[model samples]
Target: MNDKTEELRDIFTDVTDGEETVTESQEDTRGSLERDERSTEERLESVVQQMRERYGFDDVSLSDDELITVAKSFYEGDSDAEIADALGVEPETVFEARMALHLVDEDDADEVDLAAIRNREEDDATLADEYDVDETQIRRYRRIAAAEDESRTANDRYRDEFDSVLADSELSERMTTDVREDGLEDATEGMETDVEF
Candidate 1:
């Protein structure tokens, strides 16, 4: 073969070697990452279990990693709305967390329940009063009172959308909205009377 043919063959061989190297490196990276993720998930599950046992809120508990993940979302300058958007949860959840978690003296896990609840109630009362609310919500803290918090925001909508997709599009089938828009035409017909001079 001529010299040029030999040079081309050499370059092709190098390219093949580079491609194989990249593929192998990618496989190795993915394997290590999956192993680490499995371990993290197991640890997170354990933390939530412990929290449930301690708090008797078996219906409600926060994993250490999950709490940290939520905290990181806010510490990184995420508004409650933004954090709710990122975490695929309701905005009220984000606010409840931002308010309650701040009371967590992580240095002392024993103080978490007592301090967090008391502090959250105080803060909620202050916020409710500012908005001229009766502060009744501040008195009786109910979990997941959708009726009380009918104004579920965009973040909740996003989570509902995600959940709907995951449930094979059955999420909204379980929910019934108070208002149904037959169409814009019908909704505006009542207010369309002439008001001109």
Candidate 2:
């Protein structure tokens, strides 16, 4: 029994010799974890450096809660002063945060009236004035409306063509059925001369 156990051990060792050892895998896993940790630290450092440069701070620090507040303020389009007042930070700091983050663009047309621009009753300048946005944004909105209209028109044309094709197919089927019935009647009449029924 001892000799048999030794032979089995030898076979197991030979089979496993070509594979990676447990220690090597553990070391590789450790190396990967260390690399990921360093990468995360470097990214955080870069973000902090950007914030510092934008806000003109010698040493800037932000808690997670402060960051969330800043993001919310930015999304709401609050002024730098308002954001600073809300976050209890300097206006200069809010300005830097806004410049660095840029949650929304100056030319966003979310609140603009696109239909008025499409109708030509309202020009881009007029819409811009009404919406209190840049004229370029109004023009962008108009272009988007025009593209949407074009797509709708193309879709309508395709639908109409499909309906027409369906109608024509039905008409052709009816005509073929009528012709077959008339031919059958004519054939029955022609064969009546040779029948006595």
Candidate 3:
């Protein structure tokens, strides 16, 4: 050993009363390990329960399992019609359920002015006539706009939880990479050079 090595050895031995061997006791990790053993479905159910309790979604017609299905399908980028098919419900029902769960799509409230609707004193029928939209459409848009406002106040915590439950980061990254590579290949399909570098 070099001088520095020998000096370190001497210091270590002096600190250890000339002992040459050291042992360390690891912390008990069984509890933490066991906690992580829950199935994905169970974890999702737990999060759904927490959401229900936190938001008191008493008016929602969807059951716990249906709500989870909606959230999972939504995060997976399914359309309302597709989600409705999965749940054996109409698309309008799914829309209402999404509003109840604070899952408003960006375009759901885009057809009319949400600020105008919020400030107006007219009923749904009157607003629908004034906006030249269907009465149900007016109601749906108003509810979606309200949910969006509420979600903004809550920092979109519920949506984040919904995303985390089904949107695997690794899978998303891999899909993104694959899509980018495919696009690049398509863009360069006829650009190959005849001369070698």
Candidate 4:
């Protein structure tokens, strides 16, 4: 009995050590993964937020994660029927998401370049006709595009403001002089009075 126990213990120890080596390899691979590559769930969350804001689709009924999975599968060249069957949803739902996200062409599983459409600044009705998707989908895409544009504009404005502040040598010198002579509170008051918010 003692010999059998010792043999089992040795086997368990060997397995444990082997698992640690595999874990180390997995960690290395994990570290090598691209940080910019977002997971499907994260992508779904962003999509859901956009949809909610655009169309007030607060009760979309379907799982956002599952929708993203379907979208990814469709983008990977799977047919709507295939995704529907795999996910146990209606084929139309798959088709709708695929169209809304501009993953593929309306009648075919071929990839569509949504960026090109945005660059053209086509109207929603025109885009709906061109994409052969519903007008609602076109509207959703337009809303998302507008939101992204606003975000980009705000970012550009902030960058310009930051650059302007950094380039203002007179303001920098004044701040330095005031801070040295009048301390931080007085310097900040002077700045508030001199500089517009």
Candidate 5:
């Protein structure tokens, strides 16, 4: 018999007498693992292809190292404080590029979330809910949620901190007054009128 056949026989012989032979399962497991590996590599390659296409880069010519360096410098500078500072570009540019190219590491987001939850504990007064996770977990989720908010700001935390949203949202004075003409008028406090009749 060939080497593979011999190895297979040996594997079968080594199986416990009480258990049925699982030769088919072994083969299936190996096949599934190989398939998963191939799929992961294909995803990475697809991301590389998209970055090359969108940014007008020649895949063979412009290496990821060069692009990452330029992007990092643009988004977060080389020095400690300078990291997030660039001459003419906002950090969002690099964030957008990294997201578009799928180059940013996913693990970082999880870590950031963990840190945020730890820092966002109650003012040493409220009790932790049993239904809720621990302080560490809550901090992590908050950090991650904040990062996601930076990308998509429809959440309450994303709303303006100092400015009154009601005041800003009201376009016309009459409109504000019509709503507030009832008890709802309290909602439009400090909304100045510039409407010309």
Candidate 6:
């Protein structure tokens, strides 16, 4: 061996208490990681359950499993139309379900007069006319306004928990990569050329 190699070996031996090989028991190192023992799904489900109990998802049409899907898709930054396609429901249904779960899109909130919706005694149709948007849009804005009155932002309501659980599991990166790859594949699926370059 070269002098440098010999010197590294000697140093390693000295640092490792004269042992040629450094060994550590898995148990000795495991606790330092601070990992959650639960599976990703279990962690997400626990968070969802906590939300369901805390918020009392009154009049929400989605099942428990569907709600979980909504949470996951929302955390993945999927649009309501995309989430609706995944859930095999209409976008309006998904929108209402999102509102019920306090998953208000900031853009949606920004588009409407939340204060007017909050203080007015007018019904959704009237609000829609005043806002020059559809009744569904008015209804969604009203729900967002109500959630604001309750002092909860989208993050405070549920996104933070979903973000935490997915980020911890490293699923967020994987899912995002997968979605991007799928979109790229779909975009190029039919553009192959017969001629060789």
Q: What is the per-residue lDDT of model 3 for residues 1-197, given as tens digits with 9 covering 90 to 100?
A: 99999999999999999998678988876322122356667877887787778778866778889987887787778989999999998887777678766787776777777887875778899988888988988877778777887777778886776665566644655776887788899998989578697
Candidate 5 deviant stretches above 4 angstroms: 1-84, 105-107, 111-197
Model 4 over residues 91-133: C-alpha lDDT tens digits? 7677655444434334442234445565666677887888888
lDDT of candidate 1 over 104-132, digit per residue (tens): 21222231233234435356667456545
Estimate, for each residue in 1-197, the C-alpha lDDT of model 5 and write its tens digit: 99999887777767755344655444334222122233323434444454566445422233554344434443332432242253334544444444333333355444343443445546322313532545554443444444454434323321221012222323434554665575456766667677678
The most accurate candidate by lDDT is: 3
Candidate 2 residue-pair clash tally? 0
Better of 3 and 5 by TM-score: 3
Q: How does each model score on lDDT? A: 0.44, 0.54, 0.77, 0.55, 0.41, 0.73
* Model 1 worst lDDT window (10 residues): 103-112
Which structure is stronger by TM-score: 2 or 4?
A: 4
Better of 1 and 5 by lDDT: 1
Order the candidates by lDDT, highest first: 3, 6, 4, 2, 1, 5
Question: In candidate 3, where is summed lDDT lowest over 10 consecutive residues?
Answer: 29-38
Deviation (Å) of 178 in candidate 3: 13
lDDT of 6: 0.73
List, residue by residue over 87-171, the lDDT tens digit for candidate 6: 9988877776676656666786887668766889998898788788998777777777876665364447465565577644566
Clashes of 3: 0
Give the TM-score of each candidate: 0.28, 0.29, 0.63, 0.34, 0.21, 0.60
* Winner of 4 and 5 under TM-score: 4
Question: Candidate 4 or 5, higher lDDT?
Answer: 4
Q: Between which residue pairs do clashes occur in model 6? A: none
lDDT value for candidate 4? Answer: 0.55
Best by TM-score: 3
Give the RMSD in angstroms, all C-alphas superposed, for model 1: 19.2
Which scores higher on lDDT, 2 or 5?
2
